[model samples]
Target chain A: MNDRKTTQDWMKDWQALQRQYWTAWADATRGASGEAPDPATPWHEGLEQWARLFGDASKQSETAERLLATAKNYVALMQSMLAAATGKAAGDAAAPAWTEALRNGLNLPGLDAALHDNPLARMLRELRGPGAQAIDQLSASFAPFLARAREEGLAWLGAPALGYTREHQEHYQKMAAALLDYQDAVNRYNALVLKASRRSFEIFEDKLAERDEPGRRIETLRALYDLWVDAAEEAYAEVALSAEFRKVYGNVVNAQMRVRSQIQQEVERIGVDLGMPTRSELNSVHQRLHELRRTLRRRDDDALVELRRELERLRTEVEALRRRPAQAKPAAARSAARKAVKTGNARK
Target chain B: MGPIHIDPQRAVAELTTFNQKLAAGLKTLRSLDEVDYGATPREAIYREDKLVLYRFRGETSPTAKTPLLIVYALVNRPYMVDLQHDRSLVRNLLARGEDVYLIDWGYPDLSDRYLTLDDYINGYIRRCVEAVAKRCNVEKINLLGICQGGAFSLCYASIHPQTIRNLITMVTPVDFHTPDNMLSHWTRGMDVDLFVDTLGNVPADLMNWCYLTLKPVRLFQQKYVGLVDILDNKEEVENFLRMEKWIFDSPDQAGEAFRQFIKDFYQANKLVNGGLRIGESEVNLRNITMPVLNIFAEQDHLVPPSASRPLQQHIGTQDYTELAFKGGHIGIYVSGRAQREVPAAIHDWLAAR
Candidate 1:
């Protein structure tokens, strides 16, 4: 009876605290854009209000975007802990409920169900730092071609072309085939990533079990989040260092390169037809320039070698002159002659 | 009890504080302009193609006669050594009366795609070394190589041992076949020829992506999460931005160099296993008879300590000294502990020699 009363009292207090949290968020947003946040919505959704307030105009949009991206996950984790704490019944095992909360909370709302409970996958997807965007842009440009290639299958790829456009037909077929290969490679890589994510939870539970001791217990949301990160990274490192990952990672890269090579060839052909300088022509020039530079450097090296040899010979003669001090007049005359010859050589 | 004991009221308070800090931090971050690095003043002593040899000017004249030429990895900028006033390796080295010089390998475009590892080791590096030596009126200079540049330096030092007085390699991989070497492991399975032929020049972004993937959870998510703690601190934010700029500001690697490096060092494991050739000259690590100081990070994931610890086995130096830094790869150059320990260790080693 006492336990039931305490549970009721705790529930009332939790509701009151949640209202206070929403009021704080709403007040925070009110000064920015006057959008009062709905208390019914998930706590992390408050960031969207801030995101809109900042818009694309903020100078730190990139940093803000990255922060918001990770913050959303962080906030969701916080919300989960809060919810789990509020719903906890007396005598329940503490770690399991929090662990369960973390697992479910990682699957943030509005994420594709396929990526549910897989935070690593979502993190990887958002990790388009600087130069990475170019690859994504290139992939986006080829989306239509890839889609068509996927839908059409490989039936027509092997069919012999009889017309004058046979070479062109074969090129198209190669491009399509390469595209399919790339997709397959990506799928394999994703499967490995998914495997790592699943293993991370197992690691997290083991890590949590260790924290069950006095003074080691996680007492804050940040500490819990940090622990989870540690678990995820440990699991990831295991997968990344595996031979299977090595082969899969290589295949994805090589497959992408092949697809890119096919595309470049196609682009080159179009460039040649359009009278624009092709990559081949530019490459030839660059190769020649590189060769020329090497040749010039070699020539300079040879000249320096020759000069050093001449200097060594001159030094030997000077040493011989020093030894022939008995014939002082002739040696001095010879030295003078050598100086005159060197001066004449300089003029020449 | 349980693993978690987060009070409900404290959780709400923490979340509210996080939100407030985020708002303030974003505003501060927005108000900030682009961050600048390279704390010490430097004069460009030599320019060859896109490569510039810079000699750093310290407040006091260098007491050391021989200049120390830093050979940085082609994958990133050399400014990392001189990242900031407080966190600079170059500054600390200079303060210790060591003459500091660096090779700034500018961005490589399509025109540079044909440049090979031989071209890098024997061509650009050779000329830079010569320039530093000639300017300093010395026959040989102390060569300090970092990461991939360390590998290049090893090959260069071996091939032309006469030009290096003392060689220092920081977080450099000597044994590429170490089981902990994920980069080498991945490259071992790659068709480097196909990769180079297709890409012309390896995109910096692709390289960064590969590096980030090595520790995705920590690098991508955890790092940003940690950033929230320091968001409100303008000074910390500036420091973070500077480091961020350095991290992503990478050069597109010359394709031919990329191909040869991967094939020879990574796939073949030739640097340690023998039979490595740079250009026409075969690199024999046994030929690096100079006084050697090998500094490697204890927690370095990029170049595992196992990979870096084998310099003594391969090199001909009887005076080989190794310093295991108590940090990760980047920390060896920028961390406060690094600022204190690395330069002092390097200076003391050089002085002893």
Candidate 2:
């Protein structure tokens, strides 16, 4: 990614750019003097005063310089990653020896060497280990319900009076399959999650065992953090990207929705039998009322806006009149004119 | 074990440092006055439902003829741009002499469950834009959108290209089907209707959990650890806590909008594939012929750079400029680099345009 530009070349260019930025910033601020500052706004004026008092110019300069240096470091890190990733550096200045050496063995975010050494991730794994079992137990408890739902759905659909047609049979079969599919999908998703977690633990445990003699598994917080991020991103990406996960997820949701629809239909059917309004009727009413409310809201808002505009215009006019020069010849009759205007038309 | 390869003294020192940091953190938290943010002086221009349109009163008179209207995402508070006194995007723009206006999409509840993308883009955002323009007495306005708000802006701009003079999208996801787009990936197969129906308005906690688990180890764990490292520095600690507050303070999404977005954008990739419709209006990216500035985070996990990078290719705007920021999703807004680089770049670009 770096096109083999050494750290020194990159930092020098970066510093030059930083100097340019400061220069431009200074020039721009200097230019601001030509434009009049608005002090009528208290908060903005306060901010300006506060900034001036705090010597924001000097502080901002210092901040800019520091941030540039940080940016330079970031550039260097990205370069290092690139060099490490490509496994080939045409130039002599490569990533630091340790990073480069570590690069060859690391697959990262999935099966990375660092995943084994991440202490915090390991600790979290240990903490969540028991939760895995709880999920399994919960899934087991939920199974019977799903099975019963599947059976009842199939039996209901297969009833001779409802339909002896081929379409009915197909529908029943599909419903039964979907019900089972929902459970299977949930189990699969859970298993994938478990598998990912297991992978991390296995790597972490094995490393811990191997490095038991060294007792130096985790070198630094940064290292541990890098490892943990990789492990997490990898595990998540694996389960998330897999077709099985995607299909199963869709299946589970579709089945759930289908089941809910069925229940709602049944409820509506019951409601019709009892001569009562169903959810559909209520929903239609809600839709109409919602539309009406929205329309009223829009009209009210427009009216209010117009009123506000008119009020503002009147206020502006009043202010303009207050600042106007005193009237000349007609001023002699001003009192009479005002009284006449307030009451009725003045006599010719 | 060979004289304990790891030095016990080092571990002791680490523990001691941790304790010191914890004590300092507690003291800092106690001393903190109310952390008031969105510090730039602003006046409420318009309000509809929970959405508020605010116009910032800058220190200097606006240099631009047209006002810049910021459309923030619905999922979070819009105060992120105007986050703090020094670290405010609004403040910097205001300082730059740009007339800045932002749409604050307040926390949506169950009442807003029926709010579709059409209502957001066509109704709320459209009305907000019109208000800004009318208030400024301008024919058109500069539009700046952040993340999901950017997407909305794109839709709005496409639908009513006449209203937008210049368009700027920051960390906005355009191509939802990009390989690195994890959110899209997870939602790709989701039964959106079922999901939305089941939870009238998707719970903030569940959504937050999904976001957190994106990089479970880093965002959920490593971030707090990093906070601990900076605990001794009271200012840093405060900043950390402020960000922490912002991170968790997410609003439940309007169900209809979320459903449509996930299904059409994520699942079907209709936005890129040319079948995205908001209400009765068809969203044609080709309709957006305005000068476009697309800024994205290089390290943005939420909306990956690749996801945002494809806009130039899809949009009909010949005057397209892609400014790739070297920071993560949030960092692009609040980072030190963002403070100096992003606002200045935007101001200069807008000024030139």
Question: Candidate 1, clashing residue pairs?
Answer: none
- Model 2: residue A252 alpha-carbon error in angstroms: 5.4
- Pick the lDDT winner: 1
Q: Per-residue alpha-carbon lDDT of model 1 for A1-348, expressed as tens digits? A: 123557668778677767878887766555774655566678788887777767766666777787887887788888877777666542245556667888878887678876887877777877755543554576668788777755777678778877999999999888777877877887898888899998898889899889888878877788888899898998888888899999998898888888888989999999989999998899999999999989998999999999999999999999998887889888789999999999999999
Taking the tens digit of each residue's C-alpha lDDT, what string does model 1 give over B65-182? 8899999999999899999999999999999999999999999999999999988999999999999899889999999999999999999999999999999999999999999898
- Per-candidate count of clashing residue pairs (backbone under 3 Å): 0, 2
List iRMS for all predictions. Answer: 2.5, 16.0
Give the runs in model 1 whose Cα sits over 4 Å from its true position: A1-11, A27-30, A89-91, A128-153, A327-348
Provide the DockQ value for model 2.
Answer: 0.07
DockQ, in order, for the candidates? Answer: 0.51, 0.07
Regions more than 4 Å wrong, model 2: A1-184, A201-218, A251-286, A293-348, B1-5, B23-35
Error of 1 at A129 (Å): 6.0
Among these predictions, the greatest TM-score belongs to 1
lDDT of 2 by residue, A1-348 (tens): 245767676555444433433333333334332332332221112223223433434412322222232222222323233233233222222223323323322322343343343433332332342323343354457568656766676465445434556654565455445456556765565566656654554443344344334445443324433453465556656666677767765665565556445445556767998999876776557557667877886798789989999999999998887775466346757977889887766453
